[model samples]
Target: MSTLNRISTPLTELTGVEHPIVQTGMGWVAGPRLVTATAEAGALGILASATMSLRELEDAITEVKSRTDKPFGVNLRADAADAEQRVNLLTKYEVKVASFALAPKPELISRLKEHGAVVIPSIGSVRHAEKVAAWGADAVLIQGGEGGGHTGAIPTSLLLPTVAAAVDIPVIAAGGFFDGRGLAAALAYGAVGIGMGTRFLLTSDSAVPEEIKRRYLEFGLDGTVVTAKADGMPHRLLRTEFVQGLEGAGKLAQLLPTLRRTVQFKNMAGQSWLELARDGLAMKRSSGRSWNQMMLAANTPMLLKAGLVDGDTEAGMLASGQVVGVIDELPSCRELVDRIVDEAVVQLKAAAATVRSA
Candidate 1:
């Protein structure tokens, strides 16, 4: 049952985990239960904090700690108004790793490092990987265009080696990664490990409702679509009726619903109208998003919550990678990790034999 012998890379050494697999922090999907289970299973588990309030995040970190003594990470929105407070919380809790979706300020990275926490940021391009490395990031997670949620246009096969060669730090490959074959392929691409969001979300340990999980399993390789209609950013999502409707609808046609969801998200996240406006303004400045795009951004969290947390596929958005179509069953974290490791070892040995014969 122990499959640790299959891999030993800088990622496993840096994170102090037995395996180099990382369960990414998907908004509203990655929670304390799933994170604790992944950590216990010997992979790095990152708790998604973007959807949680400051108090909620604190409680979640404590809960995960209570559940497992193994090391784990917390993913943060570096652009959040309370980013500083969240960093302090990580320092206070003595969390092992701090991950960011957007590049954090150099000072923030320094602060985390000072507090004895490893800093890893998810990047979509080679330049971004280089920038974070120069800013002293401990590691970088690179996600290709095939990743779920907001993604870029580059495929992992192309992006991985580009970024891996661009940075001196360890690179973790993500997007379209589901099984042991992917693990072997990523390693061949010079990545130290692989990060998986959709694969982990479909696991038995994930808190997503069973009905929604079943819905996800129904998708084929072509069951997903990349649309900018969701948040004015290219988002990879399941090709549900709701998504098709969004694709066909005009901007004006979608405006009213987007605004309503905006208000709902504002309330759910416990942000005042003024605070939401300020965050929107910050996003606009940082990302160079137009007014329309910024307005649409408000709809993302609520829509995700509806589908992932409430099991309302008709009205909610399911952020997923293209790999969902290929995954057919839900395995517990331990079983899934062990299976991948064992399979990877077999594949590597077979390849070595081929090399010898050649």
Candidate 2:
């Protein structure tokens, strides 16, 4: 009845999921419906709480529970003003895993683990991975430069093996993973699972508009650009006219819209100016970003909302992985998960045969 036996790994055992694949929490893209579908399809589904208010997050969690009776994870902002409240919400709902885009505080990690939730943080470097493993993170998801949104310079092939060797905990690979061949490759590299964002975003269950999804499908390997102009960080995005304009325009020209989006995000997040400032200060302290970069950081959510939620490609940009070029069709979660698992089985068996012949 379950296809999980096809590929067993630490990730599947820890999360009690049938597969070792993960649907990453992309802001505005990973909502209740998509998360629920991913859960039902046997991969770990992570709800993106960075784009949600406290109440909205709770409701979304409850809705997912109503839809599926499987384990799932919630991705949270470690520096969020309501981080404690959100942790309490997860405890209240008995969510299985708690994920963070940034490294959570040591005390917070302790608190979650004590409450019977597994804590996994997304890291970009080996040192960061080692830091979290030392701090008692249950696992680490490593996303390389080819990943969507904010990313680092190291590619997955290099980053995965380096982090896997440095840390004793389970490693989940992200960036440029789309199918079963990638999964087999990750396992060979010592990763326990693969986390995917752009791949999952193209799924039929995704909340992104069909037209925006179509726009994403038109991309080739060269269709993506990693530019710091979007949010003062290295963000991989589809080469849209809007992003091109942002790249050409000076920082001064981008300031007004950035400020306006900050206000809009504040209202949407139900956070006051003082609260927003405090969060920014905390982010600045933790990340060591410049004041200018911190100011620009506020634009990320609003811009993502425009393209992902409103489907306004001209007004906002699409965050995508370099692997977007090879993906063509929109498959339902079940179809995608099953096909990947089946293909992985074939590939693994073929490799085993080659070993025997050798």
lDDT of each: 0.93, 0.93
Sequence-dependent TM-score of model 2 = 0.98
The TM-score obtained by model 1 is 0.98
What is candidate 2's lDDT per residue for 28-100, written digit by digit as tens?
Answer: 9999999999999999999999999999999999999999999999999998778999999998998999999
Worst 10 residues of 1 by lDDT: 1-10
Error of 1 at 3 (Å): 3.2
TM-score of each: 0.98, 0.98
lDDT of 1: 0.93
Q: After superposition, how far is residue 95 of candidate 1 from its true place, in Å?
A: 1.0
Q: Please provide, for model 1 over 75-114, each residue's C-alpha lDDT reduced to its tens digit, 9 standing for 90 to 100.
A: 9998888899999999999999999999999999999999
